[model samples]
Target: MANHVSSEKRARQTEVRRLRNRANMSAMKTTVKKVLEAVQKKDFSNIDALLRDAQSVIAKTRQKGSIHKNNMARRISRLNAFVNKARNAQ
Candidate 1:
């Protein structure tokens, strides 16, 4: 338990930030999954758009401090590479 008033307020703030970060992470994961699924299904038509959406979500997540900038860059890079490979294979 938080003993001091300041500690209690800090705890509350932490909880709120945790929830916000969780939501951002969830959204980022969902967008990434959507892009992967589209690729797996060989749905090239919408893959680019999905990749853009995933990149946007990921960048936003990083901006929100839910993920590190390097992590964000790596994810976007891998996703882009996968999409490119799939397109090339087609």
Candidate 2:
């Protein structure tokens, strides 16, 4: 669909970036899920570790431009709040 050379190059770059962004987002989601599961199971021993991993992944995703800074902050905040609430409930 990209007839011109520059357009073709742009299209190729877009595709590559799309794939990279998708991978980053997927990784971030998986990390978050792991943390939530640990919390849900009341596995306090590893929850902190999992939360830290999730936060790290989220920050990386934001740094990669896969997600906005505010979005990253919101996600980390919500995850932290959830974990803290569960922890305090114990």
Candidate 3:
């Protein structure tokens, strides 16, 4: 639907970026889910590593502008809270 050459190029770039952002979001979600699962299972043996990995993914995504900085901070905060509570429970 882009009649102009520049418009067409812009559209192409937008499509590529959209796909990349979607993939990044999906990856972040998966990492968060993994951490939540660990918490739900009350399994702290490997949670530290998992939390670190999730934090890394979230930070990277935030740096890339895929997610907001505040959102990332909130997520990491909640994750750590869960991890700490779980660790202290036993």
Candidate 4:
């Protein structure tokens, strides 16, 4: 429990930030999943668009501080590699 008034306010702020981060993370995961699934299925028709969207989501999440810049770069790199491999295979 937070006894001090400032401490109580900080606790509330923490909770709000937690929830917001959770939602952003969930959304980012979903976008990444969609891109991966498309790659796995060899669906190249809209893969570029999907990849672009996923990259945007990751960038936005990083901008919001929900994820680190390096983490975002790693994910985008992996996703690009997957797409490239799939394209070559097809």
Off by over 4 Å in 2: none
Using alpha carbons, what is the TM-score of model 1? 0.96
Model 4 whole-model lDDT (C-alpha atoms)? 0.94
Best by TM-score: 2
| lDDT by residue for model 4 (49-85), tens | 9999999999999999999899999999998998898
Q: Which stretches of model 1 miss by more than 4 angstroms?
A: none
lDDT of each: 0.95, 0.96, 0.92, 0.94
**lDDT by residue (tens digit), candidate 3, 1-90:** 999999999999999999999999999999989999988888888988999999999999999889899999998999898888878887
Give the alpha carbon lDDT tens digit for every residue of 1-90 in model 1: 999999999999999999999999999999999999998999888887899999999999999999999999999999999999989999
Flag regions of model 3 displaced more than 4 Å.
none
- Model 3 poorest 10 in a row by lDDT: 81-90
Model 3's C-alpha root-mean-square deviation from the true structure amounts to 1.3
Predictions: Cα RMSD each: 0.7, 0.7, 1.3, 0.8
Identify the superior model by TM-score, candidate 1 or candidate 3: 1
- Total residue pair clashes for candidate 1: 0
How many residue pairs clash (N, CA or C atoms closer than 3 angstroms) in each of the candidate models, in the order given? 0, 0, 0, 0
Candidate 3 clashing pairs, residues 3+ apart or interchain: none
Better of 1 and 3 by lDDT: 1
Find the candidate with the highest lDDT and give its number: 2
